[model samples]
Target: MNLVLGIDGGGTSCRAALATLAGDIIGRGKSGPANIMTDLTGARHNIVEAARLAFVDAGKDSTMISATDAVLGLAGTNVGGYRQQLEAVLPFRRSLVESDAVIALNGALGERDGAIAIIGTGSIFMSRKGAAMQTIGGWGFMLGDLGGGARIGRDLLQEVLVAHDDIRPGSELTHAVMAHFGGDPREIVKFAAASKPADFGNFAPLVFDFAARGDSVGSRVIARAVGDVEEALDALKLEPDQILCLLGGLAALIAPQLSHRYRMMLRPPLQDALGGAVSMAARLFGAPKGGADG
Candidate 1:
């Protein structure tokens, strides 16, 4: 009958869930972006609001949640500054802060030893060893996010601009990107300046579409993305038999194009990232506040 709360802070939305100690979900909730680096105030508001809604969905109150453990897996909280900022708000009997990648890795592998390759707004590879951890990539959406949606979208935009200027071979993506930007090339510049990683990532589906229609540019884009992610995976020091789980948008889209050798290395996860928050909460039920249990 022990109650626990799990929070998954996505780039565009924040999701919260209430579950029993044994893992049966009781309720769910949601809010806006909780990426502290991108939007700190919005991040705190989203986390608090989502937690409130989750409690309401569970027919509980804040007091109950204050007694039960709450674990928040937030995006863009990779650094200590943002972590401390989040630590100042949010209610919990015990709470722990870590990057969203850590939660994704836990959600997939649980306590088991494995590696995770996440390709969403950003891309990162993480591996767990008992209680120890290691990572590669995760350099953020700006400089590095190779193989992520933002990267793909940036490449697509470049291709479209080149096509408009007659500097590259023509393809369906040219039209799609043009249409996506409302047929104005200047809109592309504005979009890049204003869009977040997830915003640009929204264009990834179009990349898949063009590739499916036999456009070499789109095909090459997909291949390049998959290859970049593979490089991240290969950098991990996992044993030959260790299973790697692929998370996020790009991984799911490009699975068909992945080689059998890579396929053999993958392990499908039983639960999504919210499950990781749940697991963390369970372990922290009796731990001191502000300490990590996993």
Candidate 2:
């Protein structure tokens, strides 16, 4: 089939891009979650399903996937044994599995020596300097992910709780949070009891929006989150001229608020994770002739 496939599989969904060996993306499709740690079999199924759909989108039969070389960037692939397990089951001529973060870095930096901060429901920072690579703070939301959307949302809920108990003064933001729960502190309590990282992350945008409007509570929450981001970047010790790409859902909100130092280093991503997966695939296996990508 003289084609390649790029797959981006996360807890929420799996996205597949079908391209020629020459690097022109011809089709793309998405399917259900493909989190290997939690559900390896399901992840494999979804991955193949996404690939099949991509082929369909490109006006080819699903069977063409058997001849396609692919690179998949998937959540939980970094955990021991899971990546190999999924790799063995995928329906492709040659397939490589990499941590989701890797493809995102490639997508953002495009072989540049720099760093990336993915601030979504959770956050992680990564850097690549030639063959040397470093990672910081992708430890999930319970104890880590301090600078992520989930953490900011959790902080907001805590502020609401403290204000409700008279332990802290309430502000417009906190009061608004309380009002969200029908002005009942116990409702906040009930919601928090069952909330997941993304459940809390839902409130992250509100915090940043309030901060933009000069609300004290929102501003403080955002400031702390910004501090966490800066702390991670400081750990990387990036060079002055090296670019830093901010990605994920909260990136837009956090970009303007970064310190002058990082602001100077910031640049937009060169491509998205799917594009990166395709790029990696092209590099690992020779692309077809007549491609002008170079």
Candidate 3:
């Protein structure tokens, strides 16, 4: 019973699916944060926990995880040597780690030639034209991740600080944002010094909320973010009629705001990242197996 494992590990949580070479799902499981770049040891623990839980869900011995081959599409894999590092410590018989964006694109477009913009807590854009794949961004919140929740939330904090200093005009959005930080710019400064991307990302919804109410600053922020998204799409060189998917937490919120050109190309994803991992596992590693127990 040779079965492949698919794991989608992200900053928030990780999901695992055990399936056959033919793409029949056997069992699935989930666990907490698996962002290897931020917490390698914790990610390792959660990755294995999720895999173990998948085996449990399948009513199989969790120890059999060591016998399984796996494909893990994970957040933070694009940074440094974390992919190889995480792979080295994984409990699988064999494992391949890829950036989270890869699985998202594959899941959305299946085998078709298309593109995806993953705009969640972080941002990354990718396109596949046959075998050639092009990716931009996904550098994480510090260096890049423009148009993502972290970026949006961080910008809101900045707007608050500047407005407090009288350097910029304050709007309802900024005023509300300041209260989110105890109404003290000093508290925002303190929080920023020790905050993770998720901490800032928690405020992203507020930006969209205010923007919807015609808050000037919120509108400006979202407009800038949309521009970044369009810029990335333009760089992908996707022609008209090519499928374009906007995935992740912000996808629905950002969709209608995109220019008509991009809006016309949008389509819903066919499956989630875990599904993509299993599909990729079959293509990358299970082709010869042609056989799976479940």
Candidate 4:
């Protein structure tokens, strides 16, 4: 029985899955962030630790199993030196490292060609055809990530502060946002200074809760985020009838709000992103370098 390991390393968390060639999941594990660009030492630690946990859960050992191949889908991995950084840490025979978005595309569409828009802490647009890849967004937290949770949270926070100062009409969001920051704007500012952008993004759930409860301001903010994702999808040049997969928390949650005419294009994946890594690893078992079709 061939055993393979698949890892999906993101800005916030790392997920590892151990599976057989036939796609039966033996066991799974998770750890901390694995984006090397953001935290190299921490990334290595998280990846190794997550792998070990997965091996243990699968009743195996990391060093003992000489798998035919492995695949790591990581965030913050561009097409340059950062890829090399990831290759240096994890131990594997035949390995391929790609952006987390690539794995997401694979997971959503299986082997079919299509596009995917992922909105979680951050958002990215990825379209793929076999080995060919094209990307539209995911510049980073500072200038880009327009429609992601961090963007939503940031805007909502500003509104909360503005409302507190009577610049805008107050809503339930003002109270929720204030409470999230311990009911102090100054403390919230300080926390903002020390937190990762994704940390802000995590607060989106609070906004969602309020929106679900009929908070007008919160509902509008989330609605705008939904529109932003759709605009990004439209920028991908997808045909009106082409199938588009919506992957990630925000996209899946807001699928119902999308126009009914476009509903036909929106399909959820059968498995999550880690499943993509597992499938990629399975192909690497017998695939020669630059030999097998991507």
Maximum-TM-score candidate: 2
lDDT of 2 by residue, 1-294 (tens): 678899999999999999877667998989999999999999989999999999999998889888888889988766789987877787788888988999999989987899999999999999999989999988898989988999999999999888888997888999899988999988888998899999999999999989999998888899999999999999999998999999999999999999998999999999999999988887765444523221
Clash pairs (backbone) in predicted model 1: none
Candidate number of the best lDDT: 2
For all candidates in order, the CA lDDT equals 0.80, 0.90, 0.88, 0.77
Clashes of each: 0, 0, 0, 0
lDDT score for residue 140 of model 1: 72
How do the residues 126-149 of candidate 1 rate in per-residue lDDT, one tens digit apiece? 988887788888787778989888
Runs off by more than 4 Å, candidate 1: 38-42, 175-187, 286-294
Candidate 3's residue-wise lDDT over 1-294, tens digit each? 478889999878999999877777799999999989889999999999998898899888888888888889997776689888888888888888988888888889999999999998888899999999999988879988899999998988888888999998999989887877788789899999999998889888889999999999999888988888889889999999999999988999999999999999999998888999989877776888443322
Q: Give candidate 2 misplaced runs (Cα > 4 Å).
A: 287-294
Write the number of the candidate with greater lDDT, choosing between 1 and 4: 1
What TM-scores do the predictions have?
0.86, 0.94, 0.90, 0.83
Give candidate 1's TM-score: 0.86
Regarding TM-score, does 2 or 3 come out ahead? 2
